[model samples]
Target chain A: MSRETILASIRAALPPGQALPELDNFGLHYDDPIQQFITTAEAVGANLQSVDNRGGIAAAVQAFLPGASSILSHVPEVPCKNFTRDADRDPHAYSDLDLIVVEGLIPVAENAAIWVPDSQYDDHAAMVLTQHQVIIVRASDLVDHMHQAYAKVAAAEVPRFGFFLSGPTKTADIEQSLVLGAQGTRSLLIIMIRDESTSTI
Target chain B: MIDHAQHARNFTANAERTAWHDDALWFVREKRDKATKLIPEWEELREQASQVKMHMLSRLDHYLEEFERNATARGIQVHWAEDADAHNRIVHAILERKGVKNIVKSKSMLTEECHLNPYLAERGMDVIDTDLGERIVQMRNEPPSHLVMPAIHIKKAEIGDLFHEQLGTDAGADDPKYLTEAARQHLRPKYLEADAGITGVNFAIADTGGIVVCTNEGNADLGTSLPPIQIHCMGMEKLLPRLEHLGVFTRLLARSATGQPITTFTSHFHGPKPGGEMHVVIVNNGRSAILAKPEFRRSLSCIRCAACLNTCPIYRRSGGYSYGSVVPGPIGSVLSPAMDLEKYAALPFASTLCGSCTDVCPVKIDLHDQLLAWRKYVVKEGYLDKGKARQMKMAGKLLSSPTLYRTASFLSKGMKLVPRVLLYNKKNKWGMERELPLPAKRRFRDLYRKRPRS
Candidate 1:
């Protein structure tokens, strides 16, 4: 078997063992994580908004993207035209999706990335296929850096699919000119909810 | 024979484009400096990352088995390839069994190394490269010049023309935003219609038996999410011992590659989506051989950030095509020679040994030192050119004897009286693009002997 052959080669080529360094307390940590998160989110071209409660999320989304027509909301606090979760439905049907609103599990302050596991939505394609995205993150769930973020991820049940999304899809392929919305979400809006509450609608 | 100097000469012939390319890459290197400065523990992070890789390399076999076991337990089919041909065949066999015709691939240097696109294309597969830069180069029938910015060599006007011809965009429309939107619209359908999605693994976690792929465009996410079959191709060195190691790499990768805090998306796949199938192909295409060499094995720690390429003066001024390899620049110069010493013997000499690539490397690979090491190996193996060997041999003999060196230094002063034509003739390769400094009126030894005591 090629597997055995490759393993034998790797074993034969092994060098003397070196100790793995301690990773604890080694990475960067921000003084004020929330503010740092806000600053980094904007730097990467993602819009940020703060809401007093979950009830206010829908209004904020409406105010920011009033022109969005085909919206899909995975969060119950924000209702949209499409809320169906049909496993049999083709993921290709979301190519025309204008907006997708899903709740973020954890937010990293250093890079302004939000961890969204598979449990957050029915179809993972909805997050990227849409023209715009609104990820709802709790203000208190913010961490200082990726090291802390991974600690939380490792402690939880491993999802089949999870991602750390920092900003909207972007590219600088042509002449290194920064262009937003290359092959995924063109615009991303992060709505941080400060208080938990039921949907107003 | 691949003469890197000759190819570099052809690239640098266009003085205007060369300057633009140099400035463009330097701008990225500057951004990297600024981004890394924001982290107070940047140096410490680099040290930790280096140690982690060295430790991983020492016990790579144990970790690979652990990763395969965990990945297999999660329902991901793990396959191993002895070389590039075996890798291509494994992927093709999977597609053939599934009757897959259309495929979408994101940025995968491994696939490029294996030349998988052409292999599948010859079998009548409609393979589409989804990354915007990759797509542009794919349409042009060209290889990526730089790893991070594949189409960096092509100007915006050229891209506008390419889009106009291939995707029916309006001619003379060179705005990056407009061109990028055209690509987004054009590729959305391909993602939807693709029978399989193929992506490159950024990091494979042994602890979780999952793979992490980072992308600025989220092309990998969309490409894999929509398709029923997803194939991830990874070089064996991509493995990490645990999940937390990702934090160390993710923090360094984007900040090093394009100066972002992180890529737009860092997607982790532990297993196939419900009712879907996933396969992981572990390739050993010349990597185990690299591991066998203790002096050069540290080069395996490269995270493909391309920081070394951006900082390399030779890579910036001469352009990536000069190296004539899948990867170009300082890291490529060291790695290519290992593949074939005869073919890539000229690569090590392409550098100025500036050590800037070493200073900026996140994993702390001694890139310039490796280049210097490769030069010795090349000479020892008798690959060094005869003319250069003769010149070095004479220089060695002169420097060994004090009387001969002093006498030669004294005679060199009379050469200044010679005409410019005599000094700058075809036989003087060093004088081709340079001028000799005026020889000192008196030898340094003579001047030192006449100096007053302090």
Candidate 2:
């Protein structure tokens, strides 16, 4: 079998096993994760908005994307034309979505990434198909770097597929010229809710 | 096939294009420098990443078994391939079982190394490259120039023309935004229609049995999520012992490759979603041979960030195609020689030994030192050019003897008076682009003897 052959080759080539290094402190920490996350997110080309309650998500989305019309979302308070959870539709049905608002489980400060799992949003196609994306995270869920983020996920029952969404999709393929919104969402609005008891909704 | 110097010479024939290419890569290098400077613990992070890879390499077998156990327990099929041919066959079998004719693939250099596209294409299958840069190069019928930025060598106008011809974009649309949107419209349907999706693993976490894929575009995620079958291909070296170690690598990969804080998407796949089948193909492909050699073994730690390519002076001017390898740069110079010593004997000599590639490597591969070592190995294997070997031997003998060296120096000084005809011809390869230096009249030994004692 190829498996046995490959494993034998690896065993023959490998040296004796060595102890793994300590990696808990590999990531950098910030004095204020929220401020740092906001600064880093904006630097990576994401518009930021802050709110105190869940109701403010609608206001923030409207303010961020005033011209948005074809909205599809799963967040309870966000305004949308269609809810992906309402029906058993194909992922491609939301191909022309103008805006998608989903809740992020955790906010990482080092790179401004927010963890969004498949369980949080059933139709992940909305994350990539929409013209604009808004990911809401509780301020209390913010961490300093990826180390803490991974620790949290490992501690919790993270689903089969989870992704860290940092900013809007971008590309620089044309002579290294920076261009946002190549194939995915063009604009990203990261909203941080200050309320401590912000539900998964 | 082993004429790297001649290839580089032809590449630099267009002086304007050479300068532009050099400046373009330098711009990327500068961006990397700026981004790295932002993180105060960047060096420490690189060292930590290196140590993590070192530990994984030593215990690779154990981790592979562990990963396979967990992955299989989660209903994920894990296939092992001893070489490129086996890897292609495994992928083909999986696709053939599903009767998949069309596939959407994200950027995976491993697949390129395996020649999977053509292997499937010859069998009447269509492999659609989904990454914007990869799609651009695929349409042009060329291999990727840069690892992260696949179409970096092509001009915007060329891409515009290609898209206009193939994707029906406006003929004069050279704008990057317009071209990207055109590709999006073209690929959206293909993503949904593809029977399976193939992606390369950035890091295979043993603890979680998860493969992490980082892409600025959500192409990998979109392809995998939409398809019923997800086939992830990875080299044996792409493993980390723990899930927490991902923080260290994720911080360094994007910043080193494209100066971004992070890619827009860093997705982790532990297993297939509901009703979906996930297949993980682990490929050796000469990685075991590389691992056995102590000097070149550090190369296995590479994360495919292509930071070395951006920092390499030789790579910028000569272009990626000049190296005649799928991966073409300082790392390529070291890697290609190991893969085919006789065919790629000239690659190790393509570099200037500037050590810039070594400095920028996220995993600290010791690239320049490896290049020098490959040169020594190539010569030891009797692959050196006959004339160059003779010149080096003669110089070595004369330099070992003071009298003979002085005589040779004296003769060289007198040869300045010889006609330019003898020195400027094609036989004198050194004089083709550079003039020979005028020899000094007096030797350093002679001048020192005549000087007054201090």
Candidate 3:
């Protein structure tokens, strides 16, 4: 078989195996991870909002994204007519969506990336097809760096598909000039709920 | 094979374009330095990344097998290709079996190496490159100038002309945002209509049997998410032992490439989405030959960050097309010779032996040292030009014997008194671009002998 032949060639060429390096605390630690998260996220061209409680989230969304014609969110507090979880629908149907809000399971401080499990999202296409994406996470959920973020994912059975999204889709392909929206969400809004009681409520 | 010096001469003829190219790449290098400076453990991370690659290459067969088994169990069809020909044929067979006509592709340097686009197009398949930069160069029918920034050599004005002719934009619309938007409009329907999507894998996790594809634009996601059939091609060296290893690579990749903390989309695909069918092709393509050489084995550690390309002085001045290979700059100078020494013999000579590439490498590949090694090997293989070899031989003989060296020095001094036309003839190539310095009337040895006691 071709597989056997390729593997044999690889085996023949290999030198003695070396031990894998430890990947623990591989970078600087932050005194306040949330502050670092906000600074890093903003640096990458993401807008942020700290909602006092879950009740104010919808109002904050209205205030932030007033131009959104259509809004879709799985969050119970925020009202949306077009929910992503509606069953037996084509994924491409979400292509015209103006806004889609989802909850972030974990946040990393070093880069303002949110860990969104595939299971939580009704369709992964929602994250990419929309004009703008809003990810809501508790301020306390932010970790110091990628190492800690991976520890959280490795501790449990990670979903079949997940991603660490930092900001809106962007490209520098034209002339190496950074452009915010290029085929994906134009803007990323992070609503970090500081009140612990409203994180789950 | 084309001579690198001749090819570079064509690129450097336009002094303004060369300066633009140099400044553009240097700007990326500065951004990389700034991004890396923020992390205190940047050096430690590079060391760790290097070790990970070395360890993986040592047990490559084992990890590939583990990854194959796990990926197969997850219902992803895994195929193996011994070389570029086999890789192209395998992808063709897959598309033929599925009766797919239109193919949408993201930025996969592997596909470029295999020349998959022309191969499929010859078979009456429409292959559309979805990445904006890739699309621009594809329309022009030219290979990518740089790995990360494909159209770096082409100016915005040229792109505006290309887009104007191809996409029917304004006669001279050169704005990056406007050009990008025009491309987005042009490519959206292609994405929805593509029968299959092919992507290059950034990292293949053995433990999870999944592949990670990172892109600044969400084109890869759109290409894979909407299509019914997805094909991913990756070099065997892209494997990692576990998913956690992704954390380390992810942190290092974007920061080193374009100075972003992370790419906009770091999508991880464990298997085909919903009802789609996914296939992963693992290509050897001379990678095993690299692994066999102990001295040059560290070249396998490259993560395709192109940090070396951004920082290389020779690459900046000469432009990427100067090197007669798809991959250019310092890393390509080291790698291309390993593949075809005769064809790429001039690449090793293209560098200034500056250590800037090594300093900025995320994997610590010792790029400059490898480049120097390639120079020695290429010369030993008798691939050097005959005239240059004769000159070196004569210079060697003259330097080894003191009597001959003194005679040559004395003769050279006398030649300065001769007419400039006699010495600055066509036989003397060095005098073409520069003037020869005047020789002193007194020899250093005679002057020292006659000097008064200090």
Which candidate tops lDDT? 1
- Docking tier of model 1: it is high
For candidate 2, write residues B1-454 as lDDT tens digits.
Answer: 5688888889899999999899999999999999999888999989999989999999899899988988888889999999899999999999999899889999999999999999999998899999999999999889998888898888899989999999999987898888888988899889978899999999998988889999988899888877789999999999998888898899899999988888999998988867779999999999999989999999999999999999898899999988889889998888888899999998998888989999999999999999999999989999998877876788799999989987888888878788999888865656777889888778787798899987
Fraction of true interface contacts that also occur in model 2: 0.77
Which regions of candidate 1 deviate over 4 angstroms? A195-201
- The alpha-carbon RMSD values of the candidates against the true structure, listed in the order shown, are 1.7, 2.0, 2.5
Deviation (Å) of B292 in candidate 1? 0.8
**Range of the 10 consecutive residues with the lowest summed lDDT in candidate 2 chain B:** B424-433
lDDT for each residue of candidate 1 in B1-454, tens digit (9 for 90 to 100): 4788888889889999999999999999999999999988998899989999999999999999999999999999999999999999999999999999999999999999899999999999989999999999999999989989999899999999999999999999999999998998899889988999999999999989999999999999998999899999999999999998888999999999989999999999999988899999999999999999989999999999999999988999988888888889999999989988999999999999999999999999999999999999999999997777887888899999999998989889898888999888767666777888988888898899999998
What is the interface RMSD, in angstroms, for predicted model 3? Answer: 1.1
Clashes of each: 0, 0, 0
| Candidate 3, A1-201: lDDT as tens digits | 778888888888998889998876754689888898999899888899987878778987888788888888878877775544674568778778899888998899999988988766688777787789888888878888887888888787856678888888888877688888888888899999988864573
Can you tell me which runs of candidate 2 are displaced by over 4 Å?
A: A24-27, A84-88, A195-201, B439-443, B447-454
Candidate 3, B359: how far from true, in Å?
Answer: 1.5
* Leading candidate by TM-score: 1
**Model 3 residue-pair collision total:** 0
Better of 2 and 3 by lDDT: 2
